[model samples]
Target: MERVGLYPGTFDPVTMGHLDIIGRGMKLVDRLIIGVAVSEAKRPLFLLEERIEMMKEECGKLEGPGRAKVEVLPFDTLLMHFAESVGANVIVRGLRAVSDFEYEFQMTAMNEALNREIETVFLMADVRHQAVASRLVKEIARFGGDITSFVTPTVKERLLEKYRK
Candidate 1:
């Protein structure tokens, strides 16, 4: 049985921290599906298409031999439903702090109740990226602070472009 994993997030800008989780998540599954959430509630800076394109561009750099095949898609339904729809054996999540764990823990419990077949795996963010979050990244960029360290050049350019408009 091929092991497919789902990593679901809004990915408003697809930061380096997100890429870190994705790159590491690939090692644990045969295929990785990056489910970009259509989180209208978050009022994302980038449109759904723009977010998908950014994820594709950054994820393209991670593709190569010995790594899981990566696919990016948009989803706006229950997470477990999306995972099942994609035939995922696990749902990968990133943990950067205790607060993240608290929220994820509740989510995992709810998801487990919904469907115990798919497990949730949490990957700790790299120390350098532990403090990085899409919301914070946008704030820094909005104030003209350097965000080159939080995201890739392509993402940084896209983010700046958004603010310029």
Candidate 2:
């Protein structure tokens, strides 16, 4: 039985913190699936396809543990459904602050209720990258603040282009 992990998020613009979690999570699973959620409520800066492409580009650069494959997939349904479809036994989530806990905790509990076989694992963001988030990046970029440090070069370029239009 392979230990596959599912990491789901509405990565409007994949940040360093996200990559950090992905890198660490990949070490613990035989396969890691980065699930890009089509969250209409979030009003993400990047479209689903753009977000998927950005994540794919970044994930492609990662080299995980032996025989550990990384895949970027798009999902619009419940997370548990996505996890089961991907054969994931674990769900990976990143926590940057205490405020994020309540929501994540609730979600984890709900996921457990949905599928007791799947476990949710949380990773604390690296201290230096703790403040990086897609929403904040978009807000800053909207006002022309320096976001080069928050996102990848590809993402930064896309943000700039989007804002410039």
Using TM-score as the measure, which candidate wins? 1
lDDT of 1 by residue, 118-158 (tens): 99999999999999999999999999999999999989998
C-alpha RMSD for every candidate: 0.5, 1.2
For each candidate, the alpha-carbon lDDT, in order, equals 0.96, 0.91
Stretches > 4 Å off in candidate 1: none
Give every collision pair in model 2. none
| lDDT per residue (tens digit) for residues 1-165 in model 2 | 889999999998899899999989988899899999999999887899999999999888887446358999999999999999989999999999999999999999999999999999999999989999889999999999999888889888998999999
lDDT of candidate 1 at residue 58, scale 0 to 100: 91
Which pairs, if any, clash in model 1? none
lDDT of 2: 0.91
Worst 10 residues of 1 by lDDT: 57-66
